[model samples]
Target: MELTYLRTFREVAKWGSFTKAAETLGYAQSSITTQIQKLEEAYGAVLLERYGRKMVLTMAGEALLQYANYICRLHDESKEVVAKQSKGTLSIGTIETLASFYLPAYLQAYRKAYPDVNVAIQPGNEPFIIDAVKEGALDIGIILDPPFSDPELDCSILREEPLVIIVSPDHPLAGQGEIGVEDLENESLILTEDGCTYRAMLLKVLKSNQVTFKLSYEFGSLEAIKQCVTYGLGIALLPRIAVTEEVMAGKLAAIPFIHPECKFYTQLICAKKKWKSKAYVGFLELLSGGAREGDSDAGSELSK
Candidate 1:
C-alpha cells in the first residue's frame, strides 16, 4: 500500500544488493531490508530469496514487479502535477570528463535561469549513465554513443570530434605531426578504466594494427589522466573536448591519431516516457543553443 515500499523494492530488485540500493536511495541498509519485509508482510507472500551472492525474486515478487512499476510511474506523475506548475527537480547523469571540463558553464547558466527548479547531477561511466536514464533514476543523461538501440529511449548526437593522442610537450611523440596506430606499439599508455568505450576501442585498434601495449595507469577521472600525462608519466588518447584547455595551456600537446576507426561523440539521451519539466526543457535549450551569453570568451577558447 505504501509507495515508499514499492520504490525501495524496485531499487533493490534492479541492483540486487541491499547495500547498493540503500546508498542510492539515501537510506540505511537496515531500512531497505525493513521496507522489503513490510512489502512481503502486506502481500502475504514470499518475495525475495537469496541464492549465494545474488538475490532472486520468487514468482510472487516477479508478478508484483509489473504492478510496482506501474504504481511508481503513476506516483511520480501525480507528484509532478502537485508540485509548482511546470517546476520540479531535475537530475542529470554524466561522465566525469564532461562534468569536470565541459558542462560547468552550461549548468551554472541553467541554475540562474531556472531558480525555482532544483537541478542536481550524478556521475558515472557511459553504460551506467545510460542505464540510469532508462530506469528513470536520472531525468537526462550525457554519454558516449550508446552501444545499441532501444525503442524506450531517444538520443541525439551533440558533438563529434576525432580522438586525439596527447602527451607532454617534451615527449618524443609530441613532435610528430600525426602518429599512425603502429607507432604506439610498446608505448606506455594512460587510459580510462578497462571497460570504458574509448579505452576498449583504442586497445582494439592497437591489436588490429599489431601493436603490443602496456597500461602505465588506469584512471576513472579525466583530471588524473591529464596530470599523469603532463609530467611525462604516460601518453593518452582522449576526446579533444576533454583536454582542450590543457592542450591550449601548453601543459600537453594533442596530435591527430590517424586511424580510420578512431572517432569520439558526445550524445544526449533521455527516456521516451520521462516527464519533461520546464526546467529540463530550459536547460537543454541553453546547452544546445550555443554557449551562454557571457560564455563568449570560454566558447571562443574551446572553438580552437
Candidate 2:
C-alpha cells in the first residue's frame, strides 16, 4: 500500500518485464521483485502471470495500473500547485516565429511587472515544442494553430495573422500588388517542411484550387527560406509577421492572395490541470495585450 510499491508496480506494468522495469527504475532485479511481492501481499492477490518469458498483467494488476496513473497524476498536480504558491520559476515553449517577432516585447513587459519571477523560454517548431509541453517539460506554449489535441491540454486562439505570398524584388511577380492562386501555376516555390502549420494550409489551398507549382526547395528555417527568396531562388508563402522587415527593406514584396487570404491563428496552449504560476500568468497577459496591439498596428497599416 506504500506509494513506492505503487510506483514499482506502474513501472512493471509499463515495461511488462521485471528486469526491464528494474533497469528503468534504476533498481536491482531482486528489489523490484520484492516491491511487487510486497504489493501483491498487501492486496492479497497475484498481480502478474508468466507467459513465454514475459510478465502479463493479471486483472488485478490491470486495475491497479489505471489507479496508479491517476494517483501519480494527482501527486504531480499537487506538487505543481504548491510550487506555484511558493513562486517557483516557469518554463514556456513557443515556435520560432513568435519567438522572433513577439516574445521580446512580451518578456520585457512581463519582467517589468514581475521582476522577482524567474522565466525560461524554449523555442522550436510546433511538433517539438508541443511535445515538450505535453510531457510536462513546459508549463505553457505559444504556437501556431492546429494544436496537438490531448484531453489534458487546452488551447485558446491568441491571435490571427494573415498569410501572404512573398517574392524577391527582382522576381517577375514582385511588382504585382495582389495575386491569385492561379498565378502560381508554373512558379518555383520555396516551402517550409510538412510539419509547419502554415505550410500545410498553403498545401490545402493549392490542392483545392488544382494549382500546380514546382516546389524547388524545402527548409525548416524561416530565415533560410527568406534568404533564398532574397537571392531570387523561388517565391515563398509566409505569415505576414515573418516578412515585415524584408518587405520594409524592399528586399521582398508581399502580395496578398485575392481570394480567401489564409489566416494563421497563433494559440496559447497549456496543460489542462496545470497550476498557473505568477510568471506564467504575467507572461500570458503580456502576450494577449501585445497581440491586440499588433493587430491594431496591422489594421492601421492596411488603412494607409
Candidate 3:
C-alpha cells in the first residue's frame, strides 16, 4: 500500500468529509477519492461508506485508522530524531489562556537552558490545539484541561486552577465572599463555547441543580469574555488565571464557588507511544521538577 494513500485516508477519516480532507491536504477532491479507492482496492475491503454528503468509516476503515495514526507517528518520530541530531526544532502548541498567563516564564526559562534548540510556539483555542497535537501537526501541547479519554495520548497534570465567578463590584452577589450555585438564580451569565471542558462542567452543574439563569452571551475568545465582564455585561464563570489581573485591578470581583469550587487540572499532553528524545525529556523534567506521577514524570528520570 502506498503511504500517500494511507495519508489521504487518514485525513479523510479525520475530517469526515472528502472536500474538507482535500482542502486540508491541498489536493483535489477527485484525487482524494482516487486515493481512497486505491487504498480500498489494495486492502480488498470497503473502508468508507457515504451517507448523504458525509462519509462514515467502515469497520475496516476504523481499523486502518489506528494503523495509519501509528505509521504517521512513526514517520514523524523518525524525522524528529534525525532533526534532533542536526539542530531540529520543537513545535509546541498551547491554548490562549496558558499562552497569556503561564507559558511566558516557563518558555523564558526553557530558552535560557537550551538556547541552541529551535522552538516554535503555536497558540490557539483548546480544541484546535488538542486536535493539532493528535494529528501530529504539533509535538506536544499544554491545555487548560484534558479530553475525556484517549488511549493513544499521555496526559500529565501540570497544575490545578480554580474556577471563579466574576461580577461587577456592585452586583448583588459580588460582596457575598463565596456564593453557591443556588445564589446564581436569575443572574445574567456569560460563558465560553460548548466544547470548552470547563464550560461543559459548569453547564452540567447548572443542569443538575435545575437552576436557570439568563445566558447573556457565549464567546469563543477568552479576551472577549474578559472584556465583556469588565464592562459589567454579565457575571462570568472563568478560570482563576484568566481573570487574575482584572480582579486584582478592581475591574472585576472573583468569588469562589461555595458548593463546589469549579476546578480543573491543566495538563501537558503528548502522544503515548512516540519515542522520547533528550529534548522532550528535558522539557518534561523542567515542568515536573523530576517526579513521575501516575505514569507521567513531574520531573524526569523515568524510563520509557
Candidate 4:
C-alpha cells in the first residue's frame, strides 16, 4: 500500500531484473529483493518470478504495475501543477550522441527562456535514459530510437537525424558517391559502444544485406571514434551533424547510405500523463517551434 513499495515494484517490473533496478535506483541488490518481498507480503500475493536469467511479473505483479503507473503519474502530475518558477529543477537524460551533436542549441534556448530555472542532464544510453524517465529521475530524455507506443512515455519527433558513413578522405570508401549497404562488407568498422541505438541500427541493416558486420574498435566516446576515423583508422556510420565539421575540413568524408533503412531519428521523450510545468512546457514549445533540427544534413535521405 505504501507509495515507496509501489514505486520500487514498478522499477523492478519495468526492468525485469532486480539487479538492474537496484543499480538504477541507487539501492543495494538485497534492498531491491527485500522491497519486492515486502510488497508481495503487503499484497498477499506473488509479484514476480524468475524466468531463466531474467525475472518476470506474475499476474499479481502485472495487476500491481498498472495501478503503480497510474498512481505515480497522478503523483507527479499533482507536484508539477503546483510547481512555480521559483521551485524545482528540470532534470534531463540523454544519449551522448545527441548530447554532443544536437542538444546544445535547445539547451541554450531553454536557458534563455527560463532564466530563473535550473536544468540538469545525465548522459546515458537509450535504455538508461528511458528507465530514468520512467522512474521519475528525469523530466525529459532526448534519444535516437525509432518511435513506438508506450503507456508510460510520450515521444515528440524533433528531427530526422540522418546518418552518414564517415572515413578519412583518402580511405577507399571516401567520395564513392553514395555507397550501397553491400559496400560495407569486409570493411573495418569503428563504432560507438555495443549498446548504442545507432550502432544497433547500422548492424541490423548490414546483417539484412548479408554484409559481414565486424567491429574494428569500439569507443565509449563519439569524439574518440571521430578522431580515429579522421586518421583513417576505420569507417563509421554516424549522425551527419557529428561529423560535419570534420567532413567540411576535408579531414573526413560523409558518404551517404543508399539503403532506405539506414536512417535514424531524434525524439523528445517524457513521462506520459504527467503535468508539464511552465519551464517544461516552454522547453517543449521551443522544440515544437523547430529549433531541435538546426543541423542541416550534409547528405542523406530523411523523410518525416
Candidate 5:
C-alpha cells in the first residue's frame, strides 16, 4: 500500500471526520474520500463506516491504524537516517500566551539553524496540545501550566512562569505591596477563555476563598484582556511574561499577587517514542537548553 494513503487513513481516523482530516492535511474533501477508498480497496475491507455525523473506523480499520502508525513513523525515520538531511517539517502545538510572548526568539534561532526545515505552529489549549503530541500529530507541545506528566511523554519544566494580576496603573490596588484573594472581593475581573490554566486557577482561588467577584469581560485573546485591563475595565490574571513590556511602560501595573496554588510553569512535552529528526532535536535543544548547538546567545535572554 502507498504511504500517503496510510497517512490519509490515519488522519481520517484521528479526527473521525473526513472534512476535518481534509482540512488538516490540506486536501480537498473529495481527495480525502478518494484516498480512503483506495486504502480500503488495497486492504480489501470496509475500513470506515458512517455513524450519525462521524466517520468511525471498522474492526479492520482499527487493526490497520495500529500498523499505519508504526509504518508511517518508521518510514519518516528511515528517510532521515538514510538521507541524513536537515530538511523536513516540524509541527509544534502551543498555547497563545507562549506563542505570542515566549517562543519567538527560540523559533527564530531554530529557523536560522535549519533554514530548510519547515515549521508549523498550531495554537491550542494545553489539553488539545497534549493530545496532539500524544497522537503524533504534533512533534512538540508547549504550555503554561502546573507541573505535568504523562507516562507516554517526555515532560520537562522549561521555566517557572509567574502569574500576576494586572490592572491599570491608577487602579486602587495597583500600588499595593501585596494582594491576595480577599483583596479582589466584589471587584470586576477580566478573564481569558475557559480552557486557560491560569484562568482556571484564578477561578478556583476565588471560589475556594468565597470571594464574590464579577466577571466584567471574558476574552479569548490575550491582547484583548490586556487592553481591557489597561482601560481599567477590570483586573486580569495573566502570565508576567505576557505583560512585561506593558508593565515596564507604565501602561499596566502588576500587583504583588502570589498564591502557591496559582503557580504555573512553561513546560515542554513530546512523545517518548517520537523520532528525533535533525530539526526536531535542534528545536528541542533550543527549548530545553535555551540555545541551539553552537549558538551561544540565541534565546539566552529567555533563560534569564
Candidate 6:
C-alpha cells in the first residue's frame, strides 16, 4: 500500500534478488523480503518465484511491473511539478560514437542555458538505449542507426551520418578514393562490439559479399579500435565523424565506404507519453537546430 513498498518491489524485480535489491535501496534483506510479502498479500497473488539461481517474476508480477513503471514515473513528475523546480536532472542514453563525437557541443549549450540542471549521460548500445528510453529510465536517446520506427516512441531523423573505412596513413588502402566490399577480401578488421549498429551493418555487407576476412580484434571502446587501426593492426569501418580529427591531422586516413546498405542516420528518440520538463524541451531545441537567446554561439556550432 505504501509507495516505498512499490519502489522496493520494482527494485527486487529489476535485480531478481532480495539481497541485491536491499543493497541497491539501502535496506536490510529482511526488509526487502517483508515488502515483497506485503505486496503479494495486498494483490492476493504470488509475484515472484525462484528459477534456478535467479528469481523470476510470476505472471502476476509481470503485470504489476508494467503499471509500477508508470506509477513511479508519475510520482517523480508530480514532485517536479509541486516544487516548481527550474533546474532538474536530465538523463540521456546514447551510443559511444555520438556521445563522444556528436553530442558535446549540444550538451555544452544545454549546460549554458540551464546552469543548475544536472545532466547524466549514459553510454550504451543501440538496443539498450532504445529500451531504456521506453522504460522511462532515460529522458532521451540519441543513436546512429539505419532507419528505425517504433510505435511507442517519437523518433526524429536528425541527419545522415556517413560510414567510412579507416586506416593508418601508411596502410595500403589509405590513398584510395573510395572502397567497396570486395576491397576487404582477405583483410583484417578491427571492429566495435557485437551490438553496435554500424558494426552489424558492416558485418552484413561483408557476409553478403562473401568476402573472406579475419576478425583481428573486437572492442567496446571506439578509441581502442581507432588506435588499433592507427598502429596498422587492421582496417576498421566507423562513422566518419568519429575519425575526423585524426584524419584531418594526417594521423589516419578515411576512405569513403560506399554501399547502398551502409546508409545510417543520427536519430533522437523519446517515449511518446512522457511529460517534457523545461530542461528537456530546451535540450530538444538545441538538437533540432535552435538555441536559447544569448546562446547563439552554441546554436551556430550545432547547426554546422
Weakest ten-residue segment in model 2 by summed lDDT: 295-304
Model 4 spans with C-alpha error above 4 angstroms: 1-87, 291-304
Residue 249 lDDT (model 4): 83
C-alpha lDDT of candidate 3 relative to the true structure: 0.79
Model 5 lDDT tens row, 30-140: 999999999888889999999999999999999999999999999989787546546778998999988987888887777777888888999999889999999999999
The number of the candidate with the highest TM-score is 5
Clashing pairs in 1: none
For model 3 the local lDDT of residue 42 reads 92
RMSD to the true structure for each prediction, in A, is: 18.5, 16.5, 19.8, 20.2, 17.6, 17.9
Arranged by TM-score with the best first, the candidates are 5, 6, 4, 1, 2, 3
Off by over 4 Å in 3: 1-86, 146-149, 259-261, 290-304
lDDT tens digits by residue: candidate 2, 56-128:
9999988888988999889888887656543567788887777877566566656666666677878777887
Candidate 4 — which pairs collide?
none
Count clashes in each candidate, considering only residues at least 3 apart in sequence or on different chains.
0, 0, 5, 0, 0, 0
Q: Give the per-residue lDDT digits (tens) of candidate 1, residues 181-201.
A: 988988999989865888888
Can you give the TM-score per candidate against the true fold? 0.66, 0.64, 0.63, 0.67, 0.70, 0.69
Residue 34's C-alpha lDDT in candidate 1? 96
Selected candidate, larger TM-score, 5 vs 6: 5
Backbone clashes in candidate 3 total 5
TM-score of predicted model 5? 0.70
